[model samples]
Target: MKKRFDIYKEHYKALISLGLPIVIGQIGVIVLGFADTLMIGHHSTAELGAASFVNNVFTLAIIFSTGFSYGLTPIVGAMYGTKLYTFAGQALRNSLVANTLVALLLTVCMGILYWNIENLGQPEELLPLIKPYYLVLLASLVFVMLFNGFKQFTDGITDTKTAMWILLNGNVMNIIGNYILIYGKFGFPELGLLGAGISTLFSRVAMVVVFVIIFLRSIRFRRYKVGFFRLGLSRTVFGRLNGLGWPVAFQMGMETASFSLSAIMIGWLGTIALASHQVMLAISQLTFMMYYGMGAAVAVRVSNFSGQHDTLNVRRSAFAGFHLMVALGVVLSSIVFLLRDYLGGWFTESPEVATTVTSLIFPFLVYQFGDGLQIAFANALRGISDVKLMMLIAFIAYFVISLPTGYFCGFIMDWGVQGVWMAFPFGLTSAGLMLFARFNYMTKNR
Candidate 1:
């Protein structure tokens, strides 16, 4: 028993060592998104809604690529554990190609979506406002992909803090860009909603360029000289990368699609509901991103332990992360439960929207534990390189069950957006329970 407790102590230390940098890095990205939303919100509600629409469209691509690139963490973690620096470098190179190809595909899909924005069943007034803005953000998918690729590589080698710095710098630039472009400050032309998209594009491009330079030329990454640009692509590397990447990308994209598509569901509720949904999504993501930060740490730690053939430690790390997550979730939900009313008021002026948003707080509270569980075990599974099965589980949980339930509760039952939020507890808890059971079975038998 004492030994078990000591293991938990070490695992907790390892988690913080990994998780703190990730938390800061995630915060940088979230802050950028929040700033964009705030600036756009103040400009006009129509602009705010359009921004939400554009972001939701592009976010599918971003989340999918991030998952695809996540193939790196376990691979690099294993390589790093074995002290195989060159192999890690080669893995990073292969990841870049796989991610770039997917980015191109996502861009083409976005192009189709852009042309058909009018067909999204949104209010006629919103289509024109949403169309042009969506295209501008679409152009940045390649840059976002590149940035994610670099981030995954850095994260794989346990150098996550470097990505945090790059993200912080980019976010600062994004804010300044938003101020200059959205408001037409100084010599810049006022682009309004268009300006917000352009600002994001510029920041993404800048961040990617900076990452490439640092990886190639900076003294810090200079030692990992695993063939930055000199390595040739091998069919073997591509196959391995895809084997790890594709399922993850698909699973994550599906889950994100659940939320992104919920925007469509909320659209059926009318403008006020959609707007309230947008506000809740932005705020909820703040918590989700934090969960993601810790989950990423769990993946890294478990993968590192697995590379050492320490199955005991791997399970220990996962449980530690799960405990931390549940504790944090309970605290966060309480804060939200207590302050939902004030949160809505701070974000927008609509009293009706505030009341509607407050009503969803209970559902949000209920789902916190499930979200914590799913994130913990899915990440644990990913670390053990069992990504494909996890993806299948996510599909059933999010799409097969969650979305329809959300639609039924929200539309058919007349619960509105509150009903949509209610679906979260069911979906997340289902996914969590199934994943935890899978992890237990796998570890016990292995």
Candidate 2:
């Protein structure tokens, strides 16, 4: 017992050492989300609903892009583990190209969606607000992908603090920008939701620029400079990245679709539901992004171990990540539950929105376990390059199970938005369990 306990403790320490910076950075993102929700929610309920729809649509793109960027992590991690500095640097170059292409693809797809925004069944009055904001966000897609590429590279190399610092500062700048523009501070015109969109676009661009400059100029990256500049894009490398990236992207894209699509259903219930859903999503990020941070660490560590053929450590690290995620879900859910009443009020003064937010709390809390579970194992699978299955698992959990459940619950059961939210736990837990089973089987002997 003592020996086993000591072993687990060691894994915990290592995982936390790597994960803490990422978690802090993710918390910064959550803080920014809270600010966005608060600012937009108070600007006007109509704009809030518009922002909700637009943001939900863009989130699907962002999440899919992020997942595609994750393909870079394992590749870089493996190279970093092998001490192939030049190759890792070369891989980063390829990743940038791949990420950019993905960005353009997403941008075009979103652009098409923009062309038909009115057909989506959202309230007609929101079209004016959604259009410009959607355009602004669409323009930022490439920057978002570029940032994700750089971030995944840094994290894979275990330079987690650099991206963490960059992300934190960028988010702070975004909040300040949001304040100045959203409310028309310092003699600026109050553009409302458009202001928020402009601020977000500015922040994302700044982050990418800062990340690139740092990567290019810093002495810390001197080791990578030669390869970064000298390595031309390789067909082999590009193919590998795309092959790996698509599966992960589809996996994550489907997971996000479950929520983004649900936003549509929530929108059908009216603006109050949309506003409440937006705020609750912000609150949900407190745990989701934090778990993602740790899950990312798991990927890095597991990839590193896989590179070294240290199967034991890879297995240990993945399970350790799951344990940590479970612990986090427990702590965060408790805090959220305790503060349920006031949490909604923090976003908006609308009594209806606040009440709706409060009601969604139960489903929000229930999904934490599954959310954490899926994040840990999904990243673990990425580490092992066992990702094609993830796409199918996501489809089953989200499309086959989650979406229909939400529709049935929200409409047939008349559970409204809460019923929609209730479908999450079912989907997430199923995905988690399947992912866990896969990881367990894959590493069972090896």
Candidate 3:
């Protein structure tokens, strides 16, 4: 056991170097989300509930789009590993086109959902709050896709710091925007939830614009741009991206759907429950994104190793990543648990919401291990481009298992919001174990 774990020690520094920037960037986004939720919740619980429903709905789209964008990482990582810098650049161009197309498709789908959001059974009073915020967020999808394209491209080449700094700056802009608009400060009309939405939209656009400017002007990216401009788009590259993208999208979409669609269940409970759900969701991002940050590093490193046919180090990289994820999970879960009673009050003034958040913490902490485990191995599979089966596995874990269990617990068992959250551990752990097994089996065969 000691030797088995000892093998992983060699990979920690490399994975941390690659993953830490992503974690820092994700933490910045978390802070932005915290500010948005805090401002909106303090402004009005009604708006908070509306934001919860709308944001969770958008989360499904955002997460799905990000998954599609992830297809670029392995493709670019392989090219980078083999010193094919030009091809890696071409992959970014293709990725941009692919991501934009996905954004458009999602926009249409989200538009349809928007038209029927009232029909989804959320509180009737919050519709006015939900509609405008939803539309503003809908408008940002394209920009988000574009930024993701650039981010994944850079990450594949191991320049994680670029996205890190860009994201931090963008989030700062967002937080500033959120405060001014939400509070009616700085000659702003205090749009509340809509203000938050508009702020997010602009920040997303700025991130994309900044990435483009940097990509075009920076000497560091000159080689990649050579392919970006000269190689043009290729049918094969587009197809390759799609082939890798859709399965990942569905897989990730399913995972997010468990939380997102369940927001509807929480809505059924009442405004307070839904508002609490949103706060919990924001808090969940603290760890989820952090784990994903490490998971992404695993994907990049694993892909780099695979490109060289070094299956051994690929496995080592993945296991090392898992160790890191579990360690992060333990520490974070402990903190959240210790602070559960007071955590919700940090976001909103409502005592009831704070109490509800406290009730949900146990369920939240229970899934951290599974969440981290799944994130690491899922990215490992992504690094190797073994994604199709992952889609199926996610379907089983989230849709077939998690959703039904949530309904049974939340409704059938009359457990309310806490019951809904309890289903997460089962789904995440099952998915994590299966993914870990698959990664091991695939690597051993190699």
For all predicted structures, in order, the TM-scores are 0.96, 0.99, 0.99
Estimate candidate 1's alpha-carbon lDDT, on a 0 to 1 scale. 0.82
lDDT of 3 by residue, 232-265 (tens): 9999999999999999999999999999999999
Residue by residue across 61-98, what tens digits does model 1's lDDT show?
A: 78988888888888888888887777778777877888
By lDDT, the best candidate is: 3
lDDT of each: 0.82, 0.92, 0.94
lDDT at residue 215 of model 2 (Cα atoms): 94
Model 1: per-residue Cα lDDT at residue 251: 80
Reference-based lDDT, residue 429, model 1: 91
Off by over 4 Å in 3: 1-6
Q: Is 1 or 2 the stronger prediction by lDDT?
A: 2
Q: Could you tell me which 10 consecutive residues in candidate 1 have the lowest summed lDDT?
A: 222-231
Residue-pair clashes, model 1: 0
Number of backbone-clashing residue pairs for each candidate, in the order shown = 0, 0, 0
Q: Write the per-residue lDDT of candidate 2 for residues 1-446, one digit (tens) a residue.
A: 88876777887998898899999999999999999989988888888899889989999999999999999899999999999998888889999999998899898899899998888888888889989999999999999999998999999999999999999999999999999999999999999999998999999999999998999899988888778899878888788799889999999999999999999999898888888889888998899998999999999999999999998989999988999999998988999999999998888989999999999999998889899999999999999888999999999999999999999999999999999999999999999999999999998888
